[model samples]
Target: MNDTTATLDAPTADDALTRPFPGASPYDTYVHASLLNSLQQPLTEAPDEMGFLVTTQVMELWFTLIVHEWRTARVAFAKDDLDAALDALTRSRRALTALSGAWAPIAALTPARFNGFRAAFGRASGFQSAMYRHMEFLLGDKNAALLHGHSGDRAVHEALGETYREPSLYDEVLAFLHRQGRPVPAHVLDRDVTLPYRADPGVVETWRQIYTGPQHHPHLTLGELLTDIAELVTRWRSEHVMVVRRAMGAKPGSAGSSGLAWLQRRAARPVFPELWEVRGAC
Candidate 1:
């Protein structure tokens, strides 16, 4: 090649990708990596504390993403946009999978290792996580008391209260199904959105129909996607319980919860209960 052609083809030190910016890198600006990295201020020198703190923070980000996707799916369902709804649910399933995997770092902390830093951050339990509560509310586990727990923070309380008042993701799914000629109960369709969702026999039968119908049906695909999401959430909670058991062994949680026992009970409650219930009928 000629010298000019060679110069055009060759790499240069001034390439935009290699050029330094005057301030923070473009990636850091977009992702706020500096802010995120700066937030992990471990209260103690204990090595395990850093991993614990980071893992918890990582889960929070995942919770935020999952909640966002669930809300998107809820709106799409309301508009009878099945493709968009399914896409959002699929994204949320991936997020939930990552959230479940986040336990790895602190998953095996011995009681002694955990104790080394546990007391340093007293009364800051995982139970106090507002984002996690948002995820629960989106899953139809509305609890007014839990929403009230963040009353001290007006912004957080208001945001959570709105989610608390709105129809849950599953509620929208049922409404969509009803619009599509499924026999979702009138009472279920008209129930107070603020209240916790109870598994209705009618709803179970609706899902049962979907489950027992043609295997390639779009509605059946939706049911299976929801089931996958539920199973991932259950697995995440179960893993959390096991991690707490291994790390602290039935000790009280940092946020005044019963810790392992509380988590175990919470894990037992299935997400999208009707979807799971229909499986047995099928």
Candidate 2:
């Protein structure tokens, strides 16, 4: 037989590769991809709406992954497991980068294009994203009013309340540093966990010691990794502000926020404030 004929006549291995599953494919079952794909039911036929909806949904999933990783890191820090905590923080940093990248699809929407479907999703603003709030809470930006906003949803409220009650990831980090013989102040260490973490002079001193120590110290490496994560988060927030400006300049947000102004103010708040402060001190 000719080589071409033989190749065509033979049952190729590709057949098995393409074989269908009995019901849902293994990939679908494991990833719940069917359910995820089913969620993008845009409320309007405007072309830009799907991109906007899908981008927001994608960010929500990223937020979920980031929160999971941060929680893992927080637990690791609590156990004084530096390696595990660093691994988790590294994963979360990657997720934040991806979250920031997810804005590309909707980032350049013209105000007219956005206005087409913006009114349809009335009062359904990004401000109401519970998972994003969880991320903020984890970053030590606790807000009682924001947490209370989810009170109508008992399951969400209860879950978020626990995060509200618990020490943030940064808090655990300070406690871990204190255990490692750094002079994290007792008052700062024992401060109320539910309140927003302000930049404490003592915490700045603690980080300053780490930053100014031997150049190759593990603690300094940890500080830099955390700084990377903080910068990525800030970049994401700044990109969010730019996207809002492009889509709808200065318009009030659907959830009653002052839109661009409110987001600009929020983005101004630094994550890991002492870490940033220590750089200048060093």
Model 2: lowest-lDDT 10 consecutive positions: 12-21
Q: Against the hidden reference, what TM-scores do the models get?
A: 0.95, 0.96
User: Tens digit of lDDT per residue, candidate 2, span 106-214?
Assistant: 9889999999999999889898999999999999999999999999999999999999999999999999999999999999998999999999999999999988889
Give candidate 1 misplaced runs (Cα > 4 Å): 1-14
lDDT of each: 0.93, 0.94
lDDT of 2: 0.94
Name every residue pair that clashes in candidate 2: none
Candidate 1 at residue 39, lDDT? 97
C-alpha RMSD by candidate, in order: 2.2, 1.7
User: Candidate 1 residues 113-146, lDDT tens each?
Assistant: 9999989988888888999999999999999999
- Which candidate gets the maximum lDDT versus the true structure? 2
Top candidate when judged by TM-score against the true structure? 2
